[model samples]
Target: MNYLRGEFDLCTGCEACLLVCSNRAAGGYNPRLARLKVFRENENLINRPLVCTQCENPFCMHSCPVSAISRAEKTGVVLIDKEKCISCGSCIKACPDQMIRWDKTGKADKCDLCAGNPLCVQYCVPGALKLVKKREVPGK
Candidate 1:
């Protein structure tokens, strides 16, 4: 499956990805509301974009009491079903990366990869983000 990857050297700390992601997720331009987060590190020498890697053993999905979270069959994107969610925040708490966010509607929200083409990937400038396929190791 294809997934979004961030390259630190290519990033320019523009935060365009944050703006577009927040707008889609929060219906407003708030970086805090975005699913992914970026941190300016190394004394502002690097901007590190933190995104959900869609883990093989996802804690968020397992911690969800009502099974609201699941991996999409085709995309392998972790998703939250708002209808099934009871706002218990278990999924949020279980995430090691803290990618799960609370939406305005009191439901758990996270990156769905925009169903394929992520707004963050599209808006990311300086070629910091790219959609990549999982590669098979030659030795493996």
Candidate 2:
């Protein structure tokens, strides 16, 4: 399964990924609602794209009392079942990356690998975000 591996070195903090992701995920143009978030640090010297890693030991999955969150068998992508979510915020606290955010409806939201092709990667003009195979060395 491929997931977003964002390269800060190549990131320009354009926020295009955030816009597209937010639109798809939240049906609006709000970065805060986007599953992926970008943080600017050191007076914008570095742009960090924060996204779900879909860890093998995902804390979000385990923290969800209702089992609303689960990993996709075909793509290994972590997904949230909005219907089952209770807005308890346990998954939000469990996420180490802080990638998960509460939507307007109060459900936890995180990256789903766009079901296969990520809009973030497609719109990242700087090529900072990539959907790459899970590897031990990230590029090896």
Candidate 1 lDDT by residue in tens digits, 7-87: 888988888898999999999998889988888987999998888877767899989889888877766777898999999
TM-score of each: 0.92, 0.91
Which pairs of residues have clashing backbones in candidate 1?
none
Off by over 4 Å in 2: 135-140
User: Would you list the clashing residue pairs of candidate 2?
Assistant: none
Give the lowest summed-lDDT range of ten residues in model 2. Answer: 131-140
Evaluate all candidate structures by whole-model CA lDDT and list the values in order.
0.85, 0.85
Q: By TM-score, who's the top model here?
A: 1
Error of 2 at 113 (Å): 1.2
